[model samples]
Target: MTDIFGVVADATRRELLQVLLERYLAPESATGDISVGELVEKLGLSQPTVSKHLKVLRDSGLVAVREVGQHRYYRLEPGPLDVVEEWLVPFLSVDSLGGGLEQGEASGAFAAWSGVQMPASLRRAGESLQHPSDAGAAVGRAMADATHGTRHRFEEASEAVERKVFDPIRKKLKKD
Candidate 1:
C-alpha cells in the first residue's frame, strides 16, 4: 500500500521533508510554503531531483503546493501521517512498561510490564548491568582527528539542521 510509510521510505523524500519542516517552522513564515529553488539549494540536489521528490510528497498528500507567479511553493500538511504514527507508537515506547513497577526496580523499561510478576528477575538483570568504575581514563594519546564530512558539506548540513530541525522542534515544545 502506498501510504505515509512508503512515501517517507525514500532517503531523498526524507531530506525534502526535513527541508520543508524547517521552512514551516521558521519564525518569519505566516504561510508554510518553501520554494523549489530553496529546496534544491538546501539539499544540494539538482533541481530535477528535487521536483521529482516534491511530486511524490504532493501525490501522498503530505505536502500542499501554491503557485506564486512563476514559482511553486510547497508546504507540509502532516495530518495524513497520523495513522502511521498511531500504528507505530506502540513500538516507539511501551507505557511505563506495564504497570506498578516503581521507578528504580525496573532500572530500565519492561520493568513495569505486568506479565513479569516476579520483580526479582528484573532486579537481577539490573544488578548485572551495574558498572563498578565509571572512571574517565586520562589519555596521553591525542584524539584521532577525523572529519564527519567536507567543510562545505558540514556547514550545509549544520545550517539545515539548525534551521529545519531545531527551530521547528523548539516552537512545538513552546506551544506545550
Candidate 2:
C-alpha cells in the first residue's frame, strides 16, 4: 500500500479530495461520483495533471474509480482516513492546547465522540456549575444535563444506523 500521508500531502490531491467530499455530501448526488472531465473543469487543471494526482490517490486507497463505457468516475473512499484521525486525536486533546485537563479525560471524550473530543475546559466549566451557592448553577446544570442526554441519544442512533444499514452493505460489498 502507498503511504497514505504521503499521497495526501500534495495540495492538488487534497483539493481533489475536498471536491469529492462536497459531491458526496450534496443531496442531489446519486452516487457521489464525478467524472474526470468534471474534475478537470472544476479545478481548472489540465486533464493529465488531474489524472496523475488521481492515480496517486487511487493507489493510496483514498479514492475509488468506477468505469462506465470509456469514461471513468471517481469517489472518495473515507476508510483510510481512520488512520489519520487516530494519529491526530492525541494532538487535538485539550491538554495539548494548554494546561486544561488530564490526557486520559481528553482521550476518553475523544473516544466517546469517535475522534472529536469535548474540550476539557468546557467540561470543567460545566462541572463547576454544580455549586449550591449560586441559583444560576442549577439552571446551568439542567441545561448541561439536557445537552448530554441529547448527545448520548444521537450517538446511539448513529451506532444503530451503522450496524443495521452500513455494516451489512459493507459486508455484502466485501463478499463481492
Candidate 3:
C-alpha cells in the first residue's frame, strides 16, 4: 500500500484533490467526474503534468478513473481518506487538548445546534470549538451555530413540504 500521507504530500496533487472535491459538491455535476482536458483547462497545467499527478492519486486509491471511448474521466475516491481521518481524530479529542472542553458539554451543545446525532469525528471537531479562554470566539461560534440551526430547520421543513404536498400534487397531475 502506498503511504496515503506521501500520496497527498505534493501541492499539485492537493490542488487536484480540491478540484475534484469542488466538482463533487457542485449541484450541476451529476456524476462528479472530470475529464483530463477539463482539469488541464481549469488548472492551467499541461495534460501530461495533470496525468502524472492523477496516476499517483489512482495508485494510492485516492481517485478513480473511468474510460469513455478514448477519453478518461476521474472522480475522487474518499474511502482511502479514512486512514487520515482516523489518525487525526485522536488529536482532535478533548483529552488530547488537556481537558480544555468537557466531552458532555461539547456533545450537548453540538446536539442542541444540529438537532441530530453526529459521528464521533464531527463531535471531536466541535469540541475543539469550545475553548474556555476565548469569550469572543465563543460568541462567534454561538452565532454560527444559531445560523446553522436555522438553516437545518429550514431544509427539514422544505423537504417535508416537498414530500407531503408538492410530491403528491405532482403525482396526481401526472396521473391525469
Candidate 1: misplaced stretches above 4 Å? 99-176
Q: What clash count goes with each model?
A: 3, 0, 0
RMSD (Å) per prediction:
15.6, 13.4, 14.1
Which stretches of candidate 3 lie above 4 Å from their native place?
94-176
Best by lDDT: 2
Candidate 2, residue 69: how far the Cα is off, in Å: 1.4
Task: List model 3 lDDT by residue over 1-176, tens digit each.
Answer: 79999988899999999889768765779989999999999899999999999999999999999999999999999899889865543333323222344344433344457674544544555677656666467546644654555456657986897689767976896899
Q: Give the per-residue lDDT digits (tens) of candidate 1, residues 31-76.
A: 8899999898878999999999999899989899999899999998
CA lDDT, every model vs. true structure: 0.67, 0.75, 0.75
TM-score of 3: 0.55
